[model samples]
Target: MPSEIAPAGLRERKKEETRRLLLEGAAHLFKERGFEGTTVADIAAYANVSVRTFFRYFESKEALLLPDGVEIFAYVEHALSERPADEAPLDAVCNALLAAAKPFSASTLTALSHPLEDIENVITARLVQAFSDFEERLTVLVQRRLPPDTPDADLKAAVIACAALSAVRAVLRTRRARRASGISDTGPAPLLRAFGILHEIGSPERP
Candidate 1:
């Protein structure tokens, strides 16, 4: 469990729960049959929900493949805004990301353990189109914490954000792969370590 999970309003929590079910069900189907072979109706049935319910959660069958799409990252942006003023910006962003990831359940991990090649191909394309500004947002957050005189702050910020995001993606991918192999170490220690390393890389000495 994460040391700190962000608080969500009741209605938001309920909606997230629904979206979670849809994602888990869709992932299970995608793993068994592959993305090209799954249908909206199939996912809904697997999740024990009506097609209307599925539509309420996702715009299309393809959309089901990317439950962590723009809207989720946008929520993460909101989380980023809420971090305490005293916290390092890199730490804030990493904590915000960890908070977002902390809610994933066992079943969700099972869904994600599916071979990422096909799923990654689809979701990566969609992410590039949908959350194009995500990288920029992260850069701004990171640069805000750098010393005012730091050379190439903008470029450094971009690198930090990209590295952190890429590392996070690796963490989840590796965790899921572990779950598939019957390893149940689903704690936040690995998350903390990844961000801790990212922070070390992003932060510089004050001299």
Candidate 2:
């Protein structure tokens, strides 16, 4: 029994270690050779794992790039659950967006550091797949906040996703602009502004 338990424990630890190595390896290769130039074989080699093992962890390259979408959905769900039942869905979403911005912002910057032009073709392909997964996760979260008899729930969810994604992208763009312009603000003002704009646009009064 002890031997059995030991192997299970060791296997779990090894799985986690393998995942960490894969992510680190991908980041390095993405920066060095660009996302498009790197292959699953390259990632597997960098992680010192078999190509078969890579598939076990990630179905495709896009999965490696945006691994935290599920985790972010969980965070959004938790945030929404904590709000009072009477709170407006839009407000709850806005609050959730604010809560989520920190981690997502950090990850976006890290992902962008990977050479883009060279990797654009491959990254775009992966992103199309990844964004589909992301939309599904987001729809589930939005549906939970809407009324049971809500008309056009799917449409509303799509709009919400669009709004939220736009806000995040706009924030990143503003940050980049400021950095390029040599603005000295180190604060998260750009993200806060993005959230505020999204909140206003998503509010019921906007219609």
CA-lDDT, candidates in order: 0.70, 0.69
Question: Model 2, 95-194: lDDT tens per residue?
Answer: 7766765566454542433323344466656555555676677667777778888899888877776666657556655665666699643334555777
**Candidate 2: pairs in clash:** none
**Superposition error at 58 for model 2 (Å):** 2.7
User: What TM-score should be assigned to candidate 2?
Assistant: 0.64
* Top-lDDT structure, candidate number: 1
Q: Residue 117 deviation, candidate 2, in Å? A: 5.6
Q: Which ten-residue region of model 1 has the weakest summed lDDT?
A: 106-115
TM-score of each: 0.65, 0.64
Stretches of candidate 2 off by over 4 Å are: 1-18, 30-37, 50-56, 102-105, 108-117, 136-140, 147-157, 179-189, 200-207
> Residue-wise lDDT of candidate 1 within 12-127, one digit each (tens)?
88787777777788777877887778888998888778899888878898776555545557767777778887786667778887776666543443233332445537755665
Model 1 C-alpha lDDT versus the unseen true structure: 0.70
